[model samples]
Target: MNHAVEPIELARDCEAIAIPGGETVTLPKGTAAFLTQSLGGS
Candidate 1:
């Protein structure tokens, strides 16, 4: 699989799952993130 390397910033708080535990968590606003992957239909 090929992963993206784009950089991005959150404009608002986002909800995402935590790895390892798969727990639901809120990602606070202004969080910096990297574009990791885009699956078949995602």
Candidate 2:
């Protein structure tokens, strides 16, 4: 059997911004995030 992995695309470019005395999180433009688990059957 063949499995497929889907990725989530970013809508726009994310800029690196400083949080309220917290660490900054940066995600580049057109970032793709894949699903870690399979939802069809567990």
Candidate 3:
């Protein structure tokens, strides 16, 4: 016997979010500036 499976499709408006360590924060437009000021740029 043979079996077939259908592929799943994702919606266009779908979005993903990561919540690591249970801390939620927002980064402003000046993200590079903030990082440089705090941890220095790479």
TM-score of each: 0.65, 0.32, 0.23
For model 3, the superposed segments whose C-alpha errors exceed 4 Å read 1-20, 33-42
lDDT of 2 by residue, 1-42 (tens): 344377777777665545456667777768985434335763
Model 1, span 1-42: residue lDDT tens: 465577689899988887779999998888987655546972
Error of 3 at 35 (Å): 12
Q: Evaluated with lDDT, which candidate comes out highest?
A: 1
lDDT of 2 at 12: 72
Report lDDT per candidate: 0.77, 0.60, 0.34
Taking all chains together, the TM-score of candidate 1 against the true structure is 0.65
Off by over 4 Å in 1: 38-42
Q: What's the CA error at residue 22 for candidate 1, in Å? A: 0.6
lDDT at 14 for candidate 1?
Answer: 87
- The regions of model 2 sitting more than 4 angstroms off are 1-5, 15-23, 35-42
